[model samples]
Target: MSRVAVLMGGRSLERQVSLKSGARAEDALERLGHEVLPIDAGPDLVERLSTLAPDVAFIALHGRDGEDGTVQELLDVLGIPYTGSRVSACISCADKVLAKHVLRDRGIPTPDWHAFSETAFRELGAAQALPAIEERLAFPLVVKPAGQGSALGIKFARTAADVPMALVSAFSYDRKVLLERYVPGRDLAVSVLEDADGEPRALPIVEAVPNEEDFYDFEARYEIGRTRFVCPAELDDELTGRASELAVAAYRALGCEGFARIDLMLHADGGELDVLEANVVPGLTETSLLPQAAEAAGISFDALIARVLELALNRA
Candidate 1:
């Protein structure tokens, strides 16, 4: 087999989660008979990789330095093949505002939202900006950091009074914040993967049911048994087909390669679908939706990891 490096534990808020993902990936790669080297990604990642010189890199990094295309670009410069999207796709998908713009431009149906930078908010002052934000996206809005993942720095505001605090929390994580019209509905996730022939295909749809929280926050996502996932989600054939198609469309629109997970909300009416965001490097932990969907498609964890590595090796 190939010499594979499983990169994990970057200097991001999601470092612990990434470490778990990396450990799981490393175990799977080893099970598939690959020579695996697990690397705890840090400031000296480049130096460590130069020394290990693995044939391929399995990126299990989440958030900031890992998922925001920084590590991807570094891998590109080192001429190392890594699983998941390239730098450009990673950069675009990492930023919620940019991803939404791309989706809308591609005729994809994403939720209507407004984005503002910390500088603009400070200059305009909360008094001026808050009213403008409310006017743009009414109450029952989702406020989040534009560049974070796993639902970090996310808050739900049901009234004008809640907006300021949400903005503060969001700005703490990113200078840019997005306020999206909250769509009340079923939380669904679709995984898209490129086959051996390089054709992108959508896997089974997954419905996320948060056990305690109203939304799937970081805790609900990583905490064991905190969320119940219904794979091949209880959606009717038509809804499932549409969601799968939309997932592929979003994946292609973002120019993603290897695999990505598209998050969508099926309105409570069970008709409309609103694309939320695209995750270039989806979580690989035991609780991740991708693996659950893969299992439903009859692909074991080892096989799925092997296929991802194959895609990385064949990537142009």
Candidate 2:
């Protein structure tokens, strides 16, 4: 057993979710006979890590500094091995616009999007900008912050009148906002992990069904029973194989390390799949998709935690 620090509850919009994830992880690690220290990440994160030096850090934090590579950079300087991707990979996957570019460059299929800064939106005026966006992407577009997770600051605009409010809401969370053509389809998530052989492999595909919400928003994601996850998704062999392949490709393209959860949209016609986003540090709460995928693959929660810790130690 090794000393493991589970870092969570950072100063981010997903702080509450992070706390839940960290608590679950801490319990799993302890059950696996490891010395677990739960730390609520904050401005004094560096100091806290120094005070409780552990063999490895289980990063359960999400959004902002936790997911944007800020905390990873500090951990690197402190010479502490942590779970999930490295600094560069985390940085690339943290921003939606950047991740889309990487996926497209890698020949991965991702939805076409337009990104603009809040200042540009304000200076250009909605009348001047709205027409161009409508012409390019059409109606039923998804407006969201380029650098947030858990579907925070996300809005779906079905018409021109909804664009202004959507932009305002999204820009409130981030300076850069992305507008993408919303594709109607099934929501699927693929969790990829580096096996004992150090090879990145895709786990079972999880289909997320929102009970009442139109989209899998923050509520559907964290609220228990709000979303139903069908593991190995109800897709046929061909589609499942294709999704799994795309997921692994996306993971490698982003240079992801330990693990990641890739979200995709399976079109209604079941002919096309568009990569939505790559989550470097996916949520580990009871309602999270990654853990559900692992459980479906016959890996218990305790074993999964131990495996993630093993991956971190091996990389170190």
RMSD of 2: 1.9
Candidate 1 per-residue lDDT over residues 65-112, each given as its tens digit: 778899999999998999999999999999999999999999999989
Stretches of candidate 2 off by over 4 Å are: 124-127, 213-226
What would the per-residue lDDT of candidate 2 be over residues 168-262, giving only the tens digit for each residue? Answer: 89888889989999888898999998888779889999998778754625445546677788887998899999999999999999999888999
Clash count, predicted structure 1 = 0
Model 1 misses residue 225 by how many Å? 4.5
lDDT of 1 at 214: 43
Instruction: State model 1's lDDT.
Output: 0.88
**Superposing all C-alpha atoms, what RMSD in Å does each candidate have to the true structure?**
1.9, 1.9
Q: Give the whole-model CA lDDT for all candidates, comma-separated.
A: 0.88, 0.88
Q: List pairs with backbone clashes in candidate 1.
A: none
Off by over 4 Å in 1: 124-127, 212-226
